[model samples]
Each structure stands twice: as structure tokens, then as C-alpha cells.
Target: MSVPATPMERSVPRDARTSTARMLMICAWLSLAIVVVLSLSIGATGITLAALPDAIQHWLAGSDDDATAARHSLVLLEIRLPRTLLGLFVGAALAVAGAMMQGLFRNPLADPGLIGVSSGAALAAVATIALGNEFAAPWIGTFGPYALPISAFFGGVITTWMLVAVAGRHGQLMIGTLLLAGIAIGALAGAMSGLIAYVSDDRELRDLTLWTLGSLSGASWPKVIAVTPFAILIAFAIPRLIRGLNGFLLGEAEAFHLGINVEATKKFVVVTTAACVGAAVAVAGVIGFIGIVVPHFVRLIAGPDHRIVLPASALVGGTLMVFADILARMLVRPAELPIGIVMAAIGAPVFLHLVLKRGIGGVE
Candidate 1:
């Protein structure tokens, strides 16, 4: 009884752009939720999603006196849950940081690592892990778990500001200039980290290696609590940069004429990106490419609108990281692979393809 002429109607769409972005964003959030659940369920000691509810119920009710309940609680609450939470937060931070960096420089290749922020932060953390025990005991004791994060945060903020100062001219940041400066600074930070590694004892070397390679194996509730603020900052505060970031898609002159605070925007982005990257490094070591990969992928699906790009990047970034962490665990069985290696395996090739196809200039 249906009309045969409905082929034309099916081909026509109304405001598909809005609908598409909305759907993408929805799917992104759903993907994050599903990934988090799966992350909890798939480790060496498995906890299936179907079993999660009863586990939570017994855990909450404190009726978990039985050995099986105790085992589930130990696995879920003590080990898997913290890492899963850490992965979620760190992933979101890295992704948002990458998106913000790209938008700030108006170059798709602009990443947190490129700016020397991650290297500088990692250097600080490595120094703390390698030598702070002997030299800075008082401060470390006072700050406790916060000492490393605080040092890394300061290091990141300082490095990022130095880059901004060097690259910013009359409120305009030239992409090429910043990229060159970032390379120089990042190399210097890497050298310092290497020096620290050279002087480190076997124990210190092990710690440094893990920090650089990146892992959630060290995930603990305190570390989760440590990173929560930066995570919230990324999740909520960074979206405010969308308007200014959009303005920068045009020239800085154009953005200024449009009443955007070009200088302040540059500073805001550099500082926030530095802090976010620093916190992430302190918690998970040098996990790379989340920022670059997630945002670019989001842009492909959602167009270049910073508004859609930022939040979507955060969601997708978190989800992608969860999956990566899962793979890192499973790839080596009882032994875990570093998260950085997983990310590099994926990101390095994507970066190479972009360079080959788009060339360096086309990234802008």
C-alpha cells in the first residue's frame, strides 16, 4: 500500500549537518561509557559486565564476606577500577590538550609534545623520581603524592610560557616559528631527562623507564584524586576556548578585528594545555598522540567547528585510550605493554600519512 515514489523522499535530507554532529557526539559519549565498562571487565582477572551489578551491590552493602565476593572486590575496587578511572581522565586531558594546541596554532599537527610541554613535565617528573628522594626529602614528604605532579605542572607551565613568549609577536603566533621553537625546547628537555637517567641507579632507572614509557599499572586512588582537578578543568573549562579558537582559524588580525583577545587566548591555551599535559604526564607518563589523533578524527566527522570539535575530541579521546589500554594489557597477556607504545603504533603512521598526503603546509 506504500507509495513507490518514496525513493526521492528517502534521498532528500533536512539539516543533516546538525543531525550528524549531534549523532556523533551522542555516539562518542556512549562509546566512552561502553569502553569504560569493558576496561573494567577485561583485565587478567575478568569481571564480566553482567556480573558488575551484583558485584557493586555486594560491595556497597558490605555483604562481601565470602571469598568470591572478596576476590571480586579486590580485583574491581583495588586494581582495575583505579586504572580505568585514570585512563578515562588522562585520555580526556590528552585529547582536549591536542585539540586546543591545534586550534591555538591553526595547524592540525600542533600537539602538546610538539610544544615541549610534555617533555618538560616529564623531565621534572623523572628528576623527582630519580633524585628527589635524596635531595628534596623535606618537600617531597610535605607534598606527599602531590610533589611529583606539582613539579611537573610547574615545569610544563614554564616551558609553555617560554614558547609563547618566544613565538608571540604583537599578539600573533606564527605557526612555523612556534614549531621551530617547540622543537628546540623539547630537545633540550629530552637531553636533561637523559642526563637524569644516566645518573640514576637501577631502581631509579626502572622508575624513569616506566614513567617515560607510560602505564596505568601504577594507578591508585590517590593518583586518581590527584588528577581529578585537571580532568575537570579540561572537561569544563577548555570548552570556553572554542570561540577564540574558532576566531584563530582566520588570521590573528582577522580575529582581533572580530574583538577576540588574541594575546590572552594564546596565553590561556598555552597555560591550560601545559597544566593538562603536565598532570597527565605525572599520572601516566608520556602517553602521546591522543591530542593529535582524536581532534583530527573529530574534525573529519564534525567539521572544523571548535565547539563541536572540543567536546567530541574529549569523548572520543577517552574512548580511544580505554581501548588502547585494553589492548596494551591483552597484547602481552599477564605482562602489560606500555600505553605509549600502543599510541605511537597508531599515531606515528597516521602522522606519516598526513605528512605525505597533506604536506606540512596543508595542515594549516
Candidate 2:
């Protein structure tokens, strides 16, 4: 029989925890709505809140020959709208991936960037850009918009498989081993990327620079459409993983004893993470920190239950990127900073606080 619990061993009651978790979800969605409105309202063009209704209505009602409406439609529908949507999707994807990784590894620092997924995706994308015009011209011409994303997805999946092989030992995953191997892989990938960047012509060089650093300036209907399926699938998939992830926090053996298929869950997580991160990297280059930081922030407010952390992470992550994109636009006037830089700037403080509060020896 299980031993009797002391006061410290007692946990929050189920109904109470569920009540609070529901409230957290409500708040997260509400905040995301506010951020979206703010993102729409603030942009380079003279579009204001008042103009938004007519601008959207005009687009929905069919094209207007009026120059003013045309300009508003161009700015809102073509540019800001897609950019905001991309941020939302990419941010939500990275955050969900990070949360799952953290829960699987049982560590806060198990980031996509640190685990070789992002770097591998980046390397493949850079290689695609480097070779697209010269070697893969036929594929590029045939695939047109999808060639790079396809390559990135395969690269991310392969890298995740390799990482798991390297990091798994004695039928267990070691956080430290994964960290060390990830660093080595990331270094090699970075070096390869740099070498490719060195031999490129001006336009190729420009593509390399933008993609390597990361940005949402390339957001368009095509890019947005490319990422939608991954984001939606991940969103749809999160509900299924909650029970396994929650059990994981108690320990894997306990999870298995509770009737969980531990091996299947691990494989599912790795595969889903690869798909999510791969799609985000393909479209947005490589915005980092969101994956590592947003889930922790959600945990701070909503508690560490994966049921709460996963969905809350999605909403909070979407809200964060939407506002970050807004700040990126307004920070340097007409010239915008890379969204990656913006994420790092915001995530640094949050990460520092988590480290300090949790301490190196006390990250559970």
C-alpha cells in the first residue's frame, strides 16, 4: 500500500486545479484577442481602428477601385495581416514544442534550439537556398513555393532521430548527454551554414542573412498557408498528450504503471516536435527563445500540470509573438528588427528570472 501523505506531500484537489486551469485558459485567450486587435491597429500605414472595419469589410465584399481603400487593403490584408498571423502560428508552434520537450525530458532547458532541431532545420534551409538555383533548379521550379519547407521538414525529422540515438543510453534519456551532443551538433551546423554563406552571390547572400537571423518580413499568403497545417495539427494533437506528459512528471516507471505507453509517447513527442519546429523554421527562418521561455511563463501562472501548460503555452506564446512583431515594426521606424532579436530581448529577462528563482540545483 502507498504510504500516508504528510502536509507537504498533499497536492491540490482535482476540482480546484481544474477550476483554476480553466480560468487560465480563458484569460490566455482573452489576452490573445487583445494583442491581435493591438497588432492590427498599430502599423506603418495610416490605418487606424476606425479604418479597420471598412478595410476588412471592403476586402470581404470584393475589391474596390478606390485608391485609398486599395492602399488600406494592401497594407492590412497583404502585409500586416499575414505578418501577424505568421507570428501567431510560429510562436504557438515553438511554444507547444518546447513544452512537450520539457515535459518529456523533465527539464526546463530542453529547448528546440539546444536539442538540434532548429539548427538542423536551419542547416537544411540554408543548403536549399544555396543549392536551389544552381543544383536543384528543376525541383525548385517544380515545387516552386514548397521546395524549401519540404526539405526543412525532412531535415528536422532526421535530426531528431539522430539526436535521440546519440542522447539515449541504457534505455534512458539523459539531459546532460543531450545538451552536450546538441551543442556539438549545433556548432557543426553553424559552421556549415557559415561556409555556405561565404561563397554566395549578393542575392543569395541576402537570403542567407535574413533566414539565418530570422524575420517575418517575408510573410505572405503562401508562407502563412504553408505553416497553417502544422500549427493546426499540433493544436489538435495537444489534447491527446496531456495525460502522458502529466504522468511523466511523476516519473516514467510510474507512468507506465499507470497504463501509459511510455515508448510510444516519447516517439510521438519527438516526431511532433520535429514537424512543428521544422514548419516554423521553414517559414520564419529561426526565431528562438519562444520555445524555451513561453512555456515557463505559462507554468508560472497556470501551474506545471501539462494539461494547463500545453494549451496555455499556445495562447501566451501567440500573444507574445504578436506584440513582439508590433514592437519590431515600431522600434526603428520604417526599418524593422528581426523578430528573433526581439524574442531574445524579451526572453532573456524571463529566462534569467526562472534560473534565479529555481536555482541550478532546483529546477523541478
Candidate 3:
């Protein structure tokens, strides 16, 4: 390093990096488009691939006078559209949050829902459902349909704050202790949900169990509208923090030496992760492992840079969830399997293989 090359030359990696990034972007978009086509075409009613765009156009135009137009519009807008959008947003949010959690803890195995946030949200939702039963108590029965999600959001936020507080010391955070504390809190929340289920009447118990298992069956335009802001905000915010996250890979002291505001970055990650994952859990119940599995898969293909990994994860996660949702719908024909169960079933084998192949630290 006789001359210590110019800043631009040192900072930018030249054409190879640019070309690889462009190729990854192209592949991600192609994957997303394929997933969308599969989501629209594979349902029980069976809309043809050719007719799908026309159906979407007519629905958008609001000109549904003909029987075919009305049927197509009804299926596309009312059923498939909401479900597809929910899968997309929820997948993106969960994957982004998972990536942030892994970066924050410097651990490849870290996942958003591994913390208490999702479990806490689920427990709160179950409580709200149980309490809102008209037969249970007149005072609690006043809660409306929206109460459960609101309760879940609040539960997630509170639990996340508690985790942060417990894991922080003198402006420093301990990742190991944080993860352990999350496990402890998650166990407590799970037990509380079980107790609530045991005490509830039969109808409420059934509802509680269904909520715990998780489904995108409750997806609707209103739910999408409610979750969109948080999901989009976090999705956009995460990529901007990529440089900071990259610094974190060098450890806190080296990161700080590189001009990263380590504490602020950590806090931002924690809050953003909480907001995104909380919103997903609030709307989708306890869907799991997309965060853990999708980001790592993307990382394997895209490399360790958060710049590529985060966006790639978002696209792959959305595609995976949309396909999984399709499988959930068709798995039992008229009756639906829980999306959470489907994700866990797929994710577990993949996770085990990763552990065996790369150990807990993941691929370099």
C-alpha cells in the first residue's frame, strides 16, 4: 500500500460486484413473478394463467357487469388477491426481521420469532378472543373484532422492550443473554396461552387453538391495510442500514472504529424488527421459520453482504410464503391446513440440514 488507493477505488468493487448485483436482482424479480402466477393459478376454482391478468384488470377497473367478469373479479379481488398480498407482506417483513436479528446477535441461527415477541403476541390474541366471548363476561364481551390484533401488537411491543432492557448493560447488549431471556419469556407466554385455553368455553377454546396454530384464512383487505404501513416501512428501512449491519460482522469495537454508531444501530434494528415481526404476528398469528430459513437460503446464494441479502431474502421469502399458502389451501381440499404448520414442516428439515452441513454458524 505504497499510495493507499483513492477513496472511490477503495470503496467500490468495480464491474464484477455491479454485474453480480444486477443478476441477483433479475433472478429475484423472476422468482417473484413466477410465485405470483402460481398463487393465482393453483387455487381450487382454477383460474387459467391467460385469464388471470384479465381478471385482475377488470377487477381494477370496477366493471363487473357480466357473469364471467363478476366471477373472475370476485375470485381475484376478494379471495386470491388478499391472501397473496398477505403472504407477500408477511413474508417480506418476517424475512427482513430475521436478517436483522441474525446481524444484531452475530449468530446465523437467530430468528425473529425465536424471541418472545410472536409467542407473546399469540398469547395476547388468545386472551382477547377468550375474554371477548359473550358467554364469558359482559364487560369483556364489549371488545370488537379488532381487539385481538391490537392486543397482540401491544403484547409484542412490550415484550420486545422488556427483552432489550434485560439484555442491555451500560449501553452494551449481550446477545447470548438476550436470546436466553427470549426463550424464557416465550415459554412463559406459551404456558399462559395454554392456561387460557384450558379455562375457556368450547367455542373460545377452538378459536384460541386455531389462532395458535396460525392461518392466513383471516386475511382480508382491512388486515392488509392495517399491516401495510409497518411492513413497508421496515422493509425499506432495513436495506438502508446494510452498511451498519456489515460493520457489525467485524464485532462492536471494529464496527465503532469504522464510524458505525453501534448502540444506535442495534436499537434501530431491535425496534424495526419488533415493529415488522409484531405486525406480521398480530395479523397472521404464529406463523414461524420463514424468517430463519429464507434469509439463510438467500445468504447462501447471495453472499454475506446485507445489501444483497436483505432484498434477496424479501423476494425469496415472499415467493416461498405464497407457494406455502397455496399448499395450505389445497392440502385438505375444502378444509385448510394452518400455514404455520406447513412452514414448520418444510423449514425443520432445511434447518436440520443447515446445522449438519455448516453447524450453527452457517456458511461463510
Residue pairs with colliding backbones in model 2 are none
RMSD of each: 5.2, 3.8, 3.2
Model 2 misplaced stretches (Cα beyond 4 Å):
1-20, 164-183, 357-364
Instruction: For each of the candidates, give the backbone clash count.
Output: 0, 0, 0
Candidates ranked by lDDT, best first? 1, 2, 3
Residue pairs with clashing backbones, model 1: none
Question: Per-residue alpha-carbon lDDT of model 3 for 1-364, expressed as tens digits?
Answer: 4986776778566556656767877988898898888887777777656676677778778885767877877787787888899999888888988988888877787888788888888887888888655543553445466677778888899989899899999987777788999999999999998998888999887787778877788888988999989976876787668999999988888899999998888888888888887788888888888988888876665567898878888888888888889889898887889888999988899888977887654455
- Which parts of model 1 are misplaced by more than 4 Å? 1-14, 164-179, 350-364
Give lDDT tens digits, candidate 2, residues 97-139: 9999898878877778877888888888898998778888887
Which of 2 and 3 is ahead in lDDT? 2
Specify the poorest-scoring 10-residue window by lDDT in model 2: 355-364
Supply candidate 2's per-residue lDDT for 174: 63
| TM-score on alpha carbons, each prediction | 0.88, 0.88, 0.88
